[model samples]
Target: MAEFPRTDVFSGPKKTIKTPAWEPGYIRDSKSGKPREIPIIKQLYDVLMKLPRDTEKVFTVPKITLVRYFQKALEGANIQDFRFHDLRHTFASHFIMKTRDLPALQKILGHYSPVMTQRYAHLTNGHIRAEMEILSAVWTPIWTPSEKSVPCEVQKSFVK
Candidate 1:
């Protein structure tokens, strides 16, 4: 009954895990009537591959289970204050840094607005500044007063 397809291609002693089922058709469950796809990841694929063949009940993997796994993995790695969601942040940050493709990143992150995607815009500051410098270099003052029309010698001698 789970909406997301488990892409795990492996099997374990528990043969019930490898069966494929249709992903539930998208539905509108809220007042806004928006449809959403289930979030799938490679880790879920691995876990599903190890499931028993006869498992009939839809298994729910909670966020806490992932958080515990994250904590265990980081226990001796010398990292501090890591959260499971930080993986998403790191993915978004690195993707933006490497590709500089805001629209692609926004789609990957499932954000509806570019404003939400703009959080990663700061990563392109170097490019942004370089562009601004390029624009500034091309722009120049159009007019200057004649030296003879200046009231003071200092003003008259001013270079255009």
Candidate 2:
């Protein structure tokens, strides 16, 4: 994030903004050694748009200061064992849950291999349940209980 250049946040056609990888003073990229363009959500775009563009870099905050601020905020919110990088994981998981598109995520994340993106993929229980509900809608029941038939003991436990 410290290496993010202001010029990288480009506005494309249709008012869309994307952040291209910026690795200033580096030969083979900075973080992951892979550079890619990542589309920014409207909310993030709005926030970034509000930042003062005084320097060539978008964010003037030092890396250590930002880390300390994040740690303080996390502690204030009673969050534990969470690092800044965890936000990437959360974003990846939510993105896959919403779009179900791994290839797109792989490109956005700048992963050279799909396996790296697969490692980031995680499904929430709610998302799994929602998917199961969709499957249940399409499935045909093979055996349904008759009105006169006695419910099984196990089934009785589920009766409301």
Per-model C-alpha RMSD: 10.7, 10.1
Tens-digit per-residue lDDT, 20-123, candidate 1: 33233322122243544434455665565456645433344555886787798898797888776677777787777778799888866667899987774455
Q: Give the TM-score of candidate 2.
A: 0.68
TM-score of each: 0.46, 0.68
Model 1: CA > 4 A from native: 1-60, 120-158
RMSD of 1: 10.7
**Cα lDDT computed for each candidate against the true fold:** 0.60, 0.72
- List, residue by residue over 1-160, the lDDT tens digit for candidate 2: 3446333343665454444332333222346545544566666656665677655443568889999999999999999999999999899999999999999999877787999998898998899999999999999975666766576743764573
Query: lDDT at 10 for candidate 1?
Result: 50
- What local lDDT does model 2 show for residue 61? 83
Q: How high is the lDDT of residue 51 in model 1?
A: 68
User: How high is the lDDT of residue 143 in model 1?
Assistant: 52
